[model samples]
Target: MDTEALRWFQLVCDGMTVTEVAHVHQVSQPAVSRSLARLEAEVGTPLLQKAGRLLRPTYAGAVFKRHVDALIHRLDDGLAALTELTDPRTGTVAVAFQLSLGTFLVPGMIESFREEYPRVRFRLEQSHDALGSSMVAGGRIDLEFTSRRPRNPAVRWERLFAQPLFLAVPRRHRLARRREVSLADAAEEDFVMLRPSWELRTLSEQLCADAGFEPRVAFEVDDLPVVHGFVAAGLGVAIVPATEGEPQPVGAAAALVRLTDAGAFRDIGVAWSRERRLLPSAELFRRHVLALKGGRMPTATA
Candidate 1:
């Protein structure tokens, strides 16, 4: 049915004369009268009746007006909800990252962002880099933090920081006392690493290959802290990242030595799908992260 016709019917039924409704709507009296007639014809019933000089709604007209009123109310509510969803100060952002970032990098970034947008909320997910990038491409996550660029063409990866790889050794190990050591120096040592599914694991292997020997895998672990514990216990030495600003503590159990090899760094970055439009809150978060690209990201204490 024509909504404008129904609106005219409602106005006339509320005791307004046809001439008055026409003047209020800025239409001619004949145009308003024709619209009412069309509405009556469509409904096959008289919706308005003349009572002296004013018009009043018939039973059918009153029922239709109530339904129209409800629809209008719902439309208004939907519009308001859409506005809030896009508003930077009132929206939610969903982000995904590798488990390693949870300890230091992600938390600090979130805290800083919340300081600026106090009303914004977050839904955070921790997963391995591959799955995190897949979530972003699938639209399950608005953004992702990963150690390497995603292979998916739909996702755009922006480099945020380049963290140098470090050699983690037991405190009693000979190389632990060195300020910097070459990967070749520990070629014979057993290596503890993240599972093969992790990007860091692949990067570690590639670095070993570049160092001219394959690292003998002693054990595979998923968590960075567990890797640290194993290295501290002298089970194995691992290649780890030196996150900017956050240094790995050299305790009696373990020490972190810088890798002397040139270009031995992992590029940490943010990824998002190009096909999906980000909410205002997500966009703000993206801009904030991009602004920090020139700066350093804190690494997890191994």
Candidate 2:
């Protein structure tokens, strides 16, 4: 429990002889042994046991050292984060969003933001589209990118642009040959879907319901890449947004069919708390992203 005793114990674990630990601490060998004995007494167990004339840590001593080391490291990190928070140019940005948004939005935003504030640090938290909105509302995140505008009055949404969904199928599949596929035609086949709670999942379900039937969900996953992977593997077809760099052609494995009949598009936008004004770094980031000549993100709503 004593700090000095803990330090001596660490030295012992590092292979310091009791005589050497005593010498470093400017104490006698008896003093070192008494400190170790007192520590063992307080802990109700022997932290070290005699191995011939040398001492070695017992199992409990090894575990305790690991715990102490981790605690000390975390304390150091906590202090560093506190210091970072007080400096605008060097603060941490906690931005949360869905993976699709990360692929489409964060890269551009980060590149521009870093150009102006090279010292700014970031902590990204990615979740499903639906979950990102909730994170902003719950005060667990600083900013969020969501496909659907938040309905909760506690948060504010700014409509950036529509990310239209498209049908993706293996290139060799019959539907892949179409110039643009209708949802009705594609709905008849097996489909890989996002989980029902996701914004994309809810939208996909609604689009299929409008066509007069629920999609026969052949496989469901939260990750969009996995959806693409499934389509590439010939497991089932899927619907995904036409992200600018998307459908990274899987070696004749998949093709994208713009779904004209689905008549559905996810509104992509940024959201933050209505009660809080934008921080300087956040405002800088917003202005940079919106200033692009043809970029979708626009000014925040009033």
Candidate 3:
């Protein structure tokens, strides 16, 4: 049905003569009358009745007017919401990141962003690099922080910085006091690491390969905290990001030894689908991350 004709029918029902509605709308009276006629034909009923000099809506017209009023109100609201989403100061940014970054990096960034954009809101999702990359490609997330660059052609990956990888061992371990250690140094030691599906695990394996040894897998876990707990309990040592291996306590529950091997770093960056257009807020957040200074890798002390 024609929305404009329905609107004209509603105006005629509001105690305005057909000629008056035409005058208000700057259209001919016959044009207005034909619109109402089309509306009545479309609904297969009489929508208005001539009551003396004024036109009043019939029962069917009143019912149709209610539905039209609701549809128009919803359309107006949708347009307003679109305007707000495109507004730089009021839009919402949806972000996805690896679970490890949620501990410190993402939260700190969000807090700083909020300081600058108090009215903007955020929707955050935590997943592994693979899944986070998929979310960005599928347009489920506007932006993603991930260690692995997405291989999909439709997604764009911007390398923010490389985070140094560290060897996490129990506090009392002999190498814990060492300022730097090679992966080959722990070749014989049992290794606790994330599942192979995680990008960090692949990076760690490659690092071990570069160090000239295959690490004996002792435990396979998905959670970062669990990996840390197993290492702290002396089960085995694991190569983890500097941020993840940083000592949380003053004395250190586990010691983070710097890897002496060359190219011992994981590249982290923001990813988004080129096919999707980011909201103003998401674009601003992306710029904020790209503009961040050094310290992508937290310093680990022996």
Candidate 4:
């Protein structure tokens, strides 16, 4: 398995003809074919077979390509990391955060960080809340800004702060005028809940149970904002996080009543793999986040 043969084979698997590959590589068609043959011989199988006028990978070739694709991806990441290691200013930090935190929470932190490290690069992903722990543990990302605690042994979660949760009701609802209310007060109301897989869904359910009644779920949704929308539409009440200062009609439409329950806040945290060391840029960003413990995230203007 020569590297040149592997590259040529990969291109063919991507539907390149031998002539086209030769044209791209500025090599003779015979040269490309010879490379493919040697590659197949090394693997003890025909990697490509004629399908009419076109060439396609055999089942074994396709499986080999899958692993090759992963290897190539890891290789690219390694090269990038090597370059970054020599030049810390150009290092990239990979981050995964909850969609709920994207609007301002995560963005604000990133904005502030860039102020100090303007040339540092970042790769960001918006992940579902429940996926944070698993993503970090699996090495899919360097760090995750999440509200849920990681249950995996290889992952560590450090609480940055506790964000207060609220009971959101339609603006015209009778209880909207109150500054605070107990979970039991909403016991008889229809609930708009996030899907069962969401940790917030489970937390809301447990809160209701502690209040001595089960929530009669009227709507099931996929995300936090949708739950807010459903609650604002008067479909049902919901448990929601406090809105940022940014003007959101959805926030304005849904009157937030502070929950009187003892545990009405969720711990906001950054999670990372304990089994793996962080890259230089990632470690810097993690330290920056830790420095902000119990402080508000700096806005874009700041």
| Model 4 TM | 0.70
Q: Give lDDT tens digits, candidate 2, residues 31-109.
A: 9989989998998887887787678889998888897677667766888977777566887677887777665467667
TM-score of each: 0.72, 0.64, 0.82, 0.70
lDDT score of residue 1 within candidate 1: 77
Top-down lDDT ranking:
4, 1, 3, 2
The C-alpha lDDT values of all candidates are 0.83, 0.76, 0.82, 0.84
Which residue ranges in model 2 land beyond 4 Å of their true spot? 1-87, 131-133, 247-252, 290-302
In order, how many clashes per candidate? 0, 0, 0, 0
Candidate 1: 10-residue stretch with minimal lDDT = 244-253
Model 3 residue pairs with clashes:
none
lDDT score of model 4?
Answer: 0.84
Ranking by TM-score: 3, 1, 4, 2
Rate residue 256 of model 2 by lDDT.
Answer: 82
lDDT of 2: 0.76
Residue-level lDDT of model 4, residues 1-302, one tens digit each, is 57778888888999989999999999999999998998888899888999875679999999999988887778778988798754657788889988877776777888888888988887898787753345788786988989878889889988887777899999999999999999999999999998888888888899899899999999999988888788888999999876455334444478889898988878788999999998788888899999998887654553
Per-candidate Cα RMSD to the true structure, in Å, reads: 4.9, 10.4, 4.3, 10.6
